[model samples]
Target: MPGDGPRRGDAFEHDIQVGALRPAFEAAGLELVEIDWRAPLDDFEGLSLVLLGTAWDYQDHPREFVTRLEELGERGIIVCNPPPVVRWNAEKRYLRELERRGVAIVPTVWLDDAGHGDVAAAMNQFGTDRVVVKRQVGAGGLRQHSFSRDAMPDQDWRMGRPCMVQPFLPSVVEEGEYTFLFIDGEFSHGVLKRAAQGEYRIQSLYGGYETDFTPSAEDLAGAKAVVAALPFDDLLYCRIDMARLHSGELAVMEAEAIEPYLYPEQGPGLGERLAKAIVARL
Candidate 1:
């Protein structure tokens, strides 16, 4: 992991999130504190809630992360999205479940270990020349690959971990990804994340950028439907990421229930909204 750009996904994003939420949390008589998720469980004592904020490295220590959250929840601490939800969301295969539950998502082929041969097969299966392969437990576009039939990896090249393969969607590059943030099961705001030129991943770490967006009624309804499809009914927060499919419907790219960046810049009222929701829960 040497030369990895930053310890977290985006330093500026973390700063903005804290800046926006801290004053609002204070206004509601709450104090905001940042803690390492690996800290002693007793360190979480006396906290009314843990937002799972900025645990960006959790993908590398997935079980530990979820176990820690589970322990916190067992101690009666409020863990936003909760441990169970985090566990379910940790694996990308949950998309299959969402699809089964009537949520439209990018068509994906799950693989335990994907090599060049598998990539070829996936492209054949999806009937597309270009495809994307992503770790089942990844974040911030880390360890993701985009391949075209003409530019396949060598035969021995393998993604030595569980992953999902999907046909490369032109909409990702043409229209960018859409993020809908929800607070207490209600839509809070929308952000359009555009990848850098020549890139397909719409994460800030990859030079992607965000802009405030107001979706049309049909698209907003599509995002809300994804939220409604989540198995848990008591979620405190969710970020539903979607992309416009060729069919003109917004299909889910991700249903981020764990530690998603809420575009505070796009949603200036995010702080107050979060504070109100947190206070109501207490």
Candidate 2:
């Protein structure tokens, strides 16, 4: 099996996700080869499973990147979560599609550019007293901001390029956000992510913290339904991030299919389970 790359640093040296999966792959008689996702297509041939590990640069060059992935797929390499699913889920626009399907989601507004018009009016539509402005395509909370109407500049309302605006749900300060992990469409484990004091974003790389969480039955049911409704069956892994709405409804914040942190440290046998799932598919 091939894992996606720039396989450097202590990111995986003590990483729970890597620690769990590596031994299991070895026991299952699979060679886990880590390759740079941007390397020549020849590097990906002969792989049984290809995971799009950590290469944020691929997002910047998605067209050329996915073209290479398509080539590999055409040659019969089983890319976990699939190239199509990765392409679709990479953008936050999928939230609109999910909302259309009756799944509850955080209130969101899409803007074309950072300077179109009427940011206040859009924020009002969501009844947001405060809101977050973020890039349409981003990771690690880069370039995201939380703002009250008074804090927004007049030029910030433009919509020339796609961007996102979401009501800054304050529940993040109390209950935090929950991320549920799934393997082969089944619940594996979960983590609770807390933004740093007085901050709204909950990415560990952005000063957020996480711990193992035991989800409620409702949480599990809602999460499973969301996964079931996704338009794919061959997914290898997924992370469903959720936060509670003011009215107490669970709302999806993000659905990560590519390169999401799995927090394998939370469970004793998670790595073996993931390995078995992949082996079963092979």
Candidate 3:
């Protein structure tokens, strides 16, 4: 698994992934090694597969990251989900592709940069008083902002980066966001991520917590649709995160095929499923 070695910022999540996946890979007769992604690519010469793991800092050096993956692929190393998939998923704009494929997504207004004027315009477009502005290429809720009509930003305030604006979904705090982990095009498990009080981001780093969740048939179908809409069919793993729309239907928040943490704590079989899928790819 390609990782950031020991100094990775998200140690807790890294441990969870390694603890669960290492043994499973062993039992499946595969030798799993964790290596720093930034380590010389030559270090991976004898490795057969490069499963993108907790290289969470790749967002800061996206170009370098993609080049590394491409180099690995050129060396005949099997890059699960492949380089093209990674390239497409590195930016959040891929959400637009899913929406174009007829999948429901949280209404979004794509912008080169977001200022107070853009925020107000978005609120009017969505008919919502509150809106969220998020970086076009970000994860873990970093650099995201929430503003209500009454709490508009100053004229000079700006996101100053490519961004997307969406109406704040009340169901995020009222119910919670749901994540469905799909292994090799099949549903493996579900998790409901609930943010702590006064927070709206459902990332564990922000004091969010997860619980085992069994999706309703309709909701599960909705998540399945997201997986189906993906352009590639050979993805070894996919994470579909959804939130309820005001109409009581689930809408796509993210179709993560990158290095998403497959909540093994919530789905005990995640390790085994991933290992088996890896083997199948070989």
Q: Residue 50 of model 3: what lDDT?
A: 90
Error of 3 at 235 (Å): 0.3
Candidate 1, residue 273: how far the Cα is off, in Å: 1.2
Flag regions of model 1 displaced more than 4 Å: 1-6
lDDT of 2 by residue, 78-167 (tens): 887788988887788888888888888888878776552446766778877678777677766766777777787556444445688888
Residue 153 alpha-carbon offset, candidate 3, angstroms: 1.7
Give the alpha carbon lDDT tens digit for every residue of 1-282 in model 1.
212454554767778888889999999899998887877888889999998677788899999889899899889999997889999999988899999999999999999999999999999998899999999999889989999988998988989999999999999889899999999898999999999998898888888999889999999999999988888998888999999878999999999999988898899888888999899888
Is 2 or 3 the stronger prediction by TM-score?
A: 3
Models sorted by TM-score, best on top = 3, 1, 2
Candidate with more favorable, higher lDDT: 2 or 3: 3
**Candidate 3 lDDT, 136-252, residue by residue in tens:** 888888779999989998999989889999999999998999999999999999999999999999887788889999999999999999999999998999899999998999999
lDDT of 1: 0.90
